[model samples]
Target: MAVAYDLEGQKRAYKRWAPYYDRVYHKLLADAHAKTARAAAKAGPDILEIGVGTGLVLPWYPEGTRVIGVDLSFHMLERARDKMLSGAAPQTRLVAAMDACRLGLADESFDAVAVPFVITLVPDPEGALDEAMRVLKPGGAIVISSKLGYDTGAMAKIEEWVAPLMKKVGWSSAFRIERIKAWAEARGDVELTEIAPLFPAGWFKLMRLVKRS
Candidate 1:
């Protein structure tokens, strides 16, 4: 049996993937991430983007939002940091190479947390979400843009078969939407704010959960 999620494996994988990531993943990702970024900007002027790969979402953030983006991949984070230094990410407060499951930020410090196509990619999705909630201020928001694990689409079966290969590309197909909901519900500290389908690909969704007051 293969390990479902290995943080070190993902780190090594992303390191090998960083150079061509923007061209390949960016092209296929299209505007799915942009939509989430826009929503995140509106929800927060102090945002923490969990997987700010290559600073792709940085360009879309509002000018006033202070985005603190983190990624475990040093190679990927280097690109994000470069964008911030070059003024490509004008509102980026900082871009650090850090783990999602174990963040070093102060509790209740961020107004919102953004995880774009990233939760399922981590070793512990629940832990990652917990950490997101950890640093987020009460009433803060969380935005997620990614392909869910639910079997709603016609390609679900086919996707499942190819999931093993996809894992090498830095994502797990085993993550369920219900898992995300359950995490929030278990904490009793968040409300489902949005669960809209992302267009062009119905397999994906844009979700928002607001921390309770």
Candidate 2:
């Protein structure tokens, strides 16, 4: 197995790409926002968003929703702040330097949690999901949108091959959808639902899970 990507290296890579990340992945990001917003609508009230890079999903958030965004990179958070000032939903709150594996929040504090294209980036995905589940109230939902474990024939193979190189430069791993689903379901209280498609012709996956009471 390849060694885990270093967090500091990942941070620097993101900072370097902050100027171009959105431009290169705008379409995929937009689709994820739409999907996340729709899922959030189904599960509402106190909401938490992990890896809220550049606050791309802010616009789609339901009006009056109590949304809190957490990101690991300060530079990315700064860009998110800029987006918030320019166009993000006014109600969204941004928090900097929050680690996914150890979220500093009370137990069952949120009605729903969202992780958009973020899990694959963490070396300890299970730990991060556990933290997500810990902060969500019983029956609260966790929505994750990613391209993990996806199989789209040649394109999928190409993406897998390119993933490591991208990581070496600062991009997160391209995960398989099945692995993500399995990991989520491994926790007894979590139930997976509504796996959906996004853009790039079979390149993205959106998954919703509800934590059992």
Candidate 3:
């Protein structure tokens, strides 16, 4: 488990970054969300969105789709709510202060679960994935899109040197796609599929894991 101080620091950092987040991450998120949503079209309805910061992906959801979005940061959720209120995905529901590792939702409650760029932020990603799996109905799918492989070679060296400083200033450690795949596959019922890499040095990957009945 990550220390409470680390978690709180992360939340504070993200809150501070919220204003500029869309500008910084929008292009990457747009491409990834489009591809992931297209692939997830087969899953159908009652989607649960974990770590739904600012609800940027809410607009990309197919028409008539229902959404239940959960987030840890109250500030982020407030922004998401404001977006929703301003006619962004008018039907999407919001849940404030929910932890990814311990979802408050009932088991097998949703048809699909979408988690974009969230795994890397959590301290125990395995626990978070397990919670996602538990809430998804059998045969439902979990769609995840993230910037992976951010720590390698030169990047790894830079991170190793800068991580302590970054953590002190409330930044998260880098994530690797391979780790997420392994975590997903650890669940006995999951069937994993790795999507083609997008721009910016194969850093983005779309992973789809279907839960078997």
* The best candidate in terms of TM-score: 1
How does model 1 fare in lDDT?
0.83
Listed in order, each prediction's TM-score against the native is 0.87, 0.84, 0.82
Query: TM-score rank, highest first?
Result: 1, 2, 3
Task: Tell me the spans in candidate 3 whose CA falls farther than 4 Å from its real position.
Answer: 1-5, 150-174
Residue 77 local lDDT, model 2: 80
Q: Please, what is the whole-model Cα lDDT of each candidate in the order they appear?
A: 0.83, 0.78, 0.76
Candidate 1 on 23-75: residue-level lDDT in tens? 88665666787788788877668899999978888887877888899998889
What digit string (tens of lDDT, one per residue) describes model 2 on residues 1-213? 553647898789779877876777667578778878768757876789999877777667877677888988888788778877775577576556788888989999888899988888788888888999999998888898876555567767777887777667555435676676777767667888778776745456688889888
lDDT of 3 at 82: 84
Selected candidate, larger TM-score, 1 vs 3: 1
Candidates sorted on lDDT, descending:
1, 2, 3
Which candidate, 2 or 3, would have the higher lDDT against the true structure? 2
lDDT of 3 by residue, 25-71 (tens): 77856877766656555688788988888777777878767788898
Segments of candidate 2 deviating more than 4 angstroms: 1-5, 150-174
Model 3 TM-score relative to the real fold: 0.82
